[model samples]
Target: MDKSSYAGSPADKRLRRILDSNVGLCREDAIWALDYIRKKVADGAPAMQGLPQPRLMKNYQSFAEAAMSLLLSQRSGPMEAERLRKMLREALHGLIPD
Candidate 1:
């Protein structure tokens, strides 16, 4: 819930903006993901390696957007549900040290 911790990356700032403007389950999920990432960072999870920061953040943004869209959709079949899960996993993985 602390915005300061998320101020380091453009994608983080964008996500904070989205969280500030939205009022629903997607916002809640973002909050939870942010908290989880923060905790992971605090617990000394290794920073992401290999990928450039911008590229990693961009990927996270895309996955997050897809996941949010799926979450907001009222009608999702099993495949769509699985895709959402994958997006969320990828997004979280990318966000840990952003």
Candidate 2:
């Protein structure tokens, strides 16, 4: 996975904090960011047009998003956790263009 894109970053730290603190669900923007990356990967499009395609981009995106969702959803109880997990999975799946 592209840990480089996430590791030691303030955003990642903040995400961790949110999860550890048992905060509410993730904001829509975070979900959208993950979903957008998934779509790009599914289409085999450049993550950024001017940049070269990343090796294992799809795997990286999937892992990162799922990890983030898993952590963030921990704040909720089992029922809510399952709900959000499914939502995140569906959002990831929705990235595929019909």
Candidate 3:
């Protein structure tokens, strides 16, 4: 991710600060990751245009968004954690488009 692009974005600053200051819940991480993506999704740099998934131009975006949703939904208890673990495993082994 380009630091310069997000440098001016207040949303990005808030999210980054949150990540840096504390270890919040998975939902918070998801929110942070989402803000990160929102900050960069509009960048029209040539390298980003070449990517297979432009929104995923930064691999962290895909990883974080997926992780956040899965983690948040399974926050109820151990059973949910186990279920999410399985889902996360399957996701890791799943296909990525070219």
Best by TM-score: 1
Tens digits of per-residue lDDT for model 3, 38-98: 4454455343445565433335444554566554564545454344333322332212111
RMSD of each: 10.7, 10.3, 9.5
Clashing residue pairs in all predictions, respectively, total 0, 0, 0
Those runs of model 1 whose alpha carbons end farther than 4 Å from true positions after fitting are 1-35, 38-46, 49-51, 94-98
Candidate 3, run of 10 with poorest lDDT: 89-98
Q: What TM-score, computed on C-alpha atoms, does each candidate reach?
A: 0.39, 0.31, 0.34
**CA-lDDT, candidates in order:** 0.54, 0.47, 0.42
Q: Score candidate 1 by TM-score against the native.
A: 0.39
Off by over 4 Å in 3: 1-8, 21-23, 26-29, 35-39, 42-68, 76-98
Error of 1 at 91 (Å): 1.1
Model 2 / residue 75 / CA error / Å: 3.3
lDDT of 1: 0.54
lDDT of 2 by residue, 1-98 (tens): 23343345564444333333243445553454465555666786542343433534544665575657656654646556445544444433323221
lDDT of 3: 0.42
Model 1 CA lDDT for position 53: 83
